[model samples]
Every structure is written in C-alpha cells, then in structure tokens.
Target: MAAQASGDLSLVGISKEFETFTAVHPLDLEVPAGSFFALLGPSGCGKTTTLRMVAGLEEPTTGKILIGDQDITDTKAFRRNVNTVFQSYALFPHMTVLENVAFGLKRRGDKDAVAKAKESLELVQLGAVAKKKPAQLSGGMQQRVALARAIVNRPDVLLLDEPLGALDLKLRRQMQIELKRIQSEVGLTFIHVTHDQEEAMTMADSIAVMNAGRIEQQGDPASLYEHPKSVFVANFLGQSNLLRASIEGPGAEGTVMVSSHGQRLEADASHIPEGAREIWLGVRPEKLRLGEGGGPNRLHGVVADASFTGVATQYLVRLPWDQEITVVQQNDGSARALEGENVTVSWASHHGFVLDAAEPADAGLGHEDG
Candidate 1:
C-alpha cells in the first residue's frame, strides 16, 4: 500500500449527518499527490457528500481533513486550496468562457486573471472558444470550459463530481482520455466521485467502493475486481458468479476441498480463514473456460443463452443446481458454443477468490433467486 504520509490530501475518520439522516459514515482515505483517485458507488452512497466535504462545501460531523499534512478541517471553502467541477458544469450563463474561467482569479483580485484564464483554456484545447458564452457551446465544449475554469486557479486538489454525467457515451469516453491527460500535465491530486464503475476503472489510479454511506472496500481497480472483500463490492464493482461452498477437507499445497451442488472442488486457502466452515467462491465471467479437459476445478453446465457483443460473446450457463452462471469469451473469429449445448465450465483454483468466514452471511454473493 502507498503510504498516506506521501499524499497531498487525507481524510481521517470523516463523517457527515443531516438532521436524522446520516449522509456519510466515518471514512478515512488518502489521495496521493498527483494521483487520480475515484470514489465510486451507487446513488445515495455518500460519494458526492464526501467530495463536498473535501471541497469545503459541506462540514463533516466528525474527523479531520488534511492537506499535505496540515489540518484544514475548519477551513472555509475559499480559504482552502481546492476547486470543484460540479456535475452540471455550473458556468455563469451570462459570462463568456473567458470570463467564467477567470471568475475565481477575479474574486481573488489577481491582476493576471485574464492571462491565466486564456492559458487554462489553451490547456484544455478550448482556446478558440474562449469568448463564446456557455449556451453557445456544445455540452462537451461547455464541460471543457468548466474544467478550464476549475484548473485556472491551480488549486492543490481538484474535485470532480461526475463532470461527464451529462455527456453522451461516446463523448464521455473521449473526455475520459482528455481528463487523464490534463491530470498528468497538471500533476495535481484529483478526487473524482462517480457511480459509474466503468468510468472509475478506466481512469482512476485507485478506487474506493462505497455502499450505504460507508466504504465497503478500497484498492487498485484490479485488486478490487479480482478479490472483492464483501458481497456488495463484488456485485457493485463488476459482474461476478458466486458459488456457495462448504469446506470438505484439506488438500494439497495449502488448498482445501469444497463441495458445491454435489460437485467437489479444490481451491487455494491462502486468504480464507483457517477454520472456515463456509465460503463463497467468486469468479469473473471471463475467467471460466468452456468445454471439457479442465485440470482440477471443472463442472458441467448447459448453455442457456449466448449473445454476441462484437468484441466478445457472453454465455449464460445453467448448472445442475438451477443456478445461472455467466461466461464471456473473446470473439476470435472462431466457432463458439451454441445455445442448449452441454459444456464444461472450468477455472483454475488460483483464478478465483474466497471470502473469509467472518464476513456477513450475504458476503461475496448477491441475492439468490428462486
């Protein structure tokens, strides 16, 4: 883990409440200097609230906010060296792009506000539209203007609350690359909040998955997806097929035998509890291999449905236990499985992960359907 001491921003035991409702529970997070970190969750998970607190738009009910080792828990929004780009872009309707970008500097009475704004506009490749009003620009262009406005001040931290939410999918993806390039050039800490898992995974150096006003797990995108700590994180971060299993006995090489729906399998016990009686085995859809001739962890299933997604083909397999498992295969221009065909689903023991027994009863598995 990267040390928090090296970060430009740190939140320690932060919490926020509104009257009878707790908007955010105690949360601790660190944003490494010059790193792009994402706070990802579903709606009402308090990601936006956390960002607001960091931007000084909301006061925390408890805990300290630090910027480069200095406590700024009580600092006013303007006094703290942080800027935010809101979801709506929030540009002044009457102001031209140039004036909007220069607004913050003008408030600070900076003599070079206009020059700085022009330079920032150039940075976002929007210099040609500097004199145009917000209404005159396309949604993507308006978003760029908003970004230029935020970065013109060169704040220590830039908080982006779903700045791409309003854009169409294709434009959003294009902006994702642009945002990453800008972050690299500025070398400033970026704390972006969004409920879009794909966006977070595409842009963030690390991500914190939040749920129900609390952070369920935090890690690099790969780790979080491959080894989710709880059921919520597993399901929310990406699609996962979880199997309920009970430990049968010890096996070779620190592996354990488990039984699921009358099928016996072996899996690595390195991360599971020593005396784990029950466990949820989680495997990504793409990890499962089709056909027979699997090494150790293999099962037979009938293909229920298959869909071609251009780049990949997704298979819905039905197991003997009446559970449906999803499997995805890259489209390599080769013959693939057909619907209603019997195939064996297999994955290496090391390719999957097992949650500890101490986790919630529903951990590592979503709601089971009848």
Candidate 2:
C-alpha cells in the first residue's frame, strides 16, 4: 500500500443526547490533515460517543462533520470515507487473513482486491500469514490482520476505539509503537479513542482530555503533562501532588509566590491559574528531588514510604500539615530516603503549575487504564 494523504477532520458543535442524558455536549474540534490525534478520557467521558458520531454509527443531536471542504454529516457510514477498528478484531474466524482483508474490496467488486490485500498485509508486516486463518494466529498477529483490513480500504479517517484494549501489557506496549509507525508510514489521519493515558501519550501527536462530556484540555503530550490547566487534567493525565496554598503575591524574576502552612514558596506565573480564590500547588512526582534546601521551592517532610521499581525509587513523604506527597527519584546511585527519615523535598519553581482549589481534589481517581 503506497502512502496516502487524508483531509483534515472537523467537528463543529457536535452533540449527542438521549432521553435522560447527554453523552456528548456541543463540541468544536479540528484535526490537522494526517495527524495522529487521540480522544482520551475515562469511561463515560464522551470520548467513545464522539468517535461514534464521527464514524456515522451514531446520529448526532446537533452539528456537522467535515473533511477538508466537504460536509459528511449525513453520509451513510459505509458511504463516507471512514473506517473503524474496535476492541474486537471481528475478523472472519474461518477465512484466510488475505480473504478477510480483501472482504470489503471484493464486496465492492474491485477488480484488484486480492492484489491490494497482499500489499496491505505486507505493510502491516504480516504477509507471511496471508494464507493462514485467524484461529491459527496469535492475538497480536490477529490484531495486525484487522489493521491491514482497515488500511486496505484507504479511508479518509481511521477511527480506533480502544482497539488494543484486549492485549496484555507487553503486547499492548509493543502494538502502541507499531500503530504509530503504520500511521506515519501511511500519512493518514488517525483518530484514536482510548482511556489509557500512556497509550495516548505514546502514539498521539495531540490529545484532547475529556471529562464529563466536555474537553478539559487539548495539546501535545509534554504540554499536557507538564502544564495541565485544571484539576481534572492534572490528576487524570498522570499522578500529581496538589498542595493547599494561598497566593501571597509576585516574586523575583516573574514568579508567583504562594504560602502553604505559613511557609513561602515560588512557582512560574504561567502555572498559576487566574482568579483563583483558593489555590493548590501542582507538581509531578518525577519533578521532585528528595533532599533538603536544594531548590527555590522547598518543603520539609518525613519519608512515609519508599518503593523501588528498577528504574526509579518512589517515595511517600508526609509534611508537617499531615499531607502526604509522592516523589520519584532516578536510581542513579543518589542517596535514597528510608522510611521514617526526616527530609526535605525540593523542585525548581518553573517545574510546578497551580490549579484552583475549588475543583474536586481527587477528580480523576479510579479510572480504568484500558
């Protein structure tokens, strides 16, 4: 299969409502042509519903769907240039891999269906299994067949709705890389909807974090992880430690000063959200260094727990206010903190972001990583 280009995808004011509840609210989004975009959120956050609306599988309550300059809102699911791959591969169990991949082309009476299917299988690196039935393949190979089938159709947009959900941990991680590689090689517009934070981060050029039928934030992986805009995004996208604080005023060199339990601290002004009646200092576990008096922003705490996970050591540090904060340190021969040891946690002010204290502190806890 030669590399093919796709039109940019657009969703304008799209919403889906049932009798009692709205699965998705009015939403406006644009995906650049051939970009790997992810709709990421926990269950019931509307990511899947929004993907379904685009696939024309579910009628939208309002708004239009477009590709480039063309409107496709009312087009039939089969008529529109879109293909979907679900968690279930749904490959014909009794048919050969090539036959299954060529099913759609053959149904449409395309003369070169068999030839095209061969190329598609090769693109997914499964040409050798073209003659084998799906039952004769492993789970990962079965998944590649599903991908080859979808790519053979050459749709303007490919919608993946938790397609890797059934794979085990190691396989899922490996497939994440393969999926990204395939998308890049084909240069097709790929819209992936998944609940796994790491999967989205690993494969997507951009990600929209959804919460309660609304897009909380959308940006590149690093921006979302380093500078989340809300409590939900900060908590949901990854683990974070939020400290109760009050804005004291400005600090030296364009920094925002805050007071936590009468202790002064500094953070980059951009990290602090505006009009914050109440405040919480946001920091990532990896950004914190276990030590005393090392950074412009420092806190005194006692080591509550330490866990070594090969690559790094994670610690639970308890502050004087009785709040426990998480810290992660690279296991690079640095002194490790032991349990019940008094210590200070430090980080550069620029590494921290602030969020309004009004939102639920534990907003995104207990989400399934599938």
Candidate 3:
C-alpha cells in the first residue's frame, strides 16, 4: 500500500452538483506537499469546480476535502489554509504593491505585516516596484504583485486559476517558467488549473486531465503523454494519429500485431488492454519517420499538405482509409515531400499505443488541427 500523504492536499469522494447538472463527479485525488500539481482540461470540464471545492468557495455535495489529515469540507473559505490567484490579477489599483501584499497580513492582525509583505515582494523579485500602484505596473508585473499578495500569507496550498491567461503568448510562457521557479523556492503545494497542455506539462509535477466532470487520467507529464490509456488522453494531452486496427495475436519479442487497412503494425503488447480485440493505434506526430527507413511499422499515404515551421516541418498525410494523419520531422534541410506526393510513414514499435475502440474518442480532440 502507498504511504498516507501528510501535509498534502487530499480530496476524498468529493463531488458537486447543481439542480440537475452534475458539475463534478466523485473524485479522490492527492496533491503531494510542496509539489506543483495541475488540473488540466478544456472549458466546462469541472476542473475549476474541483478547485473551488478545495478552496472552500463551493461546498461539495458529498465527501470531504482535507488538507493533510484535517477535514476542511465545512470550513469557511477565509478559515482554510489556502489562497487563490486568479487571471484577473485583481490587485487594488489605488494600493501600492507593498500595501497590496500586506492586505492579508493586516486583516489577520500580524504585527510584522509590512515587513512580511516586503519579503514576499522580494520573493517574487518585485521589491523594486513596492511603491508603484497596480496601474503603473505592466501586465506581467501586476501579475507578480498578485502572486506576492497570495504567497505572503504562506498558505498550505496555493490555487492558481488560469493565472497567466491574460498575458500574451510570450509573456505567458515566461510566467510559466517564473511560476515553477517560485513554487520551487517556496516549497509550496501549487494546484494550478489550466486548459493549455503546454502550460500544464511545462510547469506541473503531476497533471490530472479532467473531462466531462471526471478525471480521465492523472500522472507525471511524461508518463501520461508517453503511455496514455484512453483515446481522450492520447489526443487531448498531445497530438496523436489514431489508426483503426484489430489485434492479430502476438508478434516478435512479445509485441502485439494489429492489422490496419490490410497492413500489419506492431505495438508494445503492454499498451494493448487485455481482451480488447479492436483498438485504435496511437502514435505521436513527432514519433513518425517519413520514407520508411526500415522502421517496424509502415503506412503509405499521399501528402495532402506540408508546411515549414522553423525547427520542424509538418505534413498532413491522407492514408488509404481516407484518414488524415499528421507527421512532424525536424527541418535538417533534407529532402522534403511536396503536396500531393506519395510518402511512406514509419516508426518504431515501442512508440505506438493502443486504446480500446469502445471508449469514446470524441472527447475534445482535434482542436489544433481544426
């Protein structure tokens, strides 16, 4: 048995429901102390609802919310040892950075409110801007001020609700790195909620991919991406080319052989669920190699489209089954396939994953391609 987590955030059978809508199903999750955890999914996936329950903003219809061993299900929002930083920044325009950071400490009647706030500001590298009002700071600076304000309280768990959504693409990336650095320095448990796959994978120590009020999968970013158990996870977390196939018994070295459009493909047997006859073969776009090159699995297709994307080139290949698959190859200035050209795609067996076809495959896939 796994050791019981201490000083960590744990949700036990927590769930939420409206009059007729079940926003969140029963969920049991644990965020390890001092680790960066993320609740990742698209809009209305109940990720935010789950966060709200933990924050004590929304009471769960059933079960308990615990910080370590203390049950906080009925605790008031203000009484819980948690803080949330939202995307809006929500800094007071009239208050200087120091005052904003000191607000929580002042309310709690801390004698060293100003000193503690200043230290928090320095923690976020914003002590130089202590005298500036929120209006005088840039968007990113304002964000930092908001962060300083939250962390100044030294909460057990810090909740971030799309905290970088307001920033531009470049600034968002910068904040992702900055947030990870700050989380490490403080050794605080951070539960970040975001819809962006890159943001979750880049910053979180573990990620829970929520969909339709349930957690489809939860694990370290690399494990979830490399060995997704569900089709939704395979496509939602990253780009995947899913091919319909049927199991044809075992192949060399304990690998499973599956047939797709009269072509045999080999995949790691462990990825094929027991007793699953028909499955969707999954391979990441970057995993595929163009022009065969004697790889284990091969598929011939016509290049429907091709585009150079600086570091890599993307090709849309239409297979014989009329499914369009994406292939990405590094731009080494090598020979490239043109539109309407016939090309062979291949990849090593281990790179492939198999998912049960009976499971729903339409859970928020193809957003990038669309």
Worst 10 residues of 1 by lDDT: 361-370
Number of the top lDDT candidate: 2
lDDT scores for all predictions?
0.86, 0.91, 0.90
Clash count (model 3, backbone only): 0
Which of candidates 1 and 2 reaches a greater TM-score?
Answer: 2
- All candidates: CA RMSD in angstroms? 3.7, 1.2, 3.1
Q: What's the candidate order when arranged by decreasing TM-score? A: 2, 3, 1
Candidate 3 lDDT, 168-229, residue by residue in tens: 99999999999999898878889999999999999999999998899999999999999998
User: To one decimal, what is the Cα RMSD in angstroms of model 3 from the true structure?
Assistant: 3.1
The TM-score values for the models, in the order shown, are 0.92, 0.98, 0.96
lDDT of 1 by residue, 1-370 (tens): 1112234798999999999899999988888888999999877889999999998889999999998878989999989888899879888999999999999899989999999999899989999988889999999999999898888878788899999999999999999999988888777788899888889989999999888799999999999988888878878777888888888888888788888888998888785655668888778898888864445799898999999999999999999988999999889887799999999999888778886545563442342210
TM-score of 3: 0.96
Decide which is better by lDDT, 2 or 3: 2
Give the C-alpha miss distance for residue 41 in model 3, angstroms. 0.9
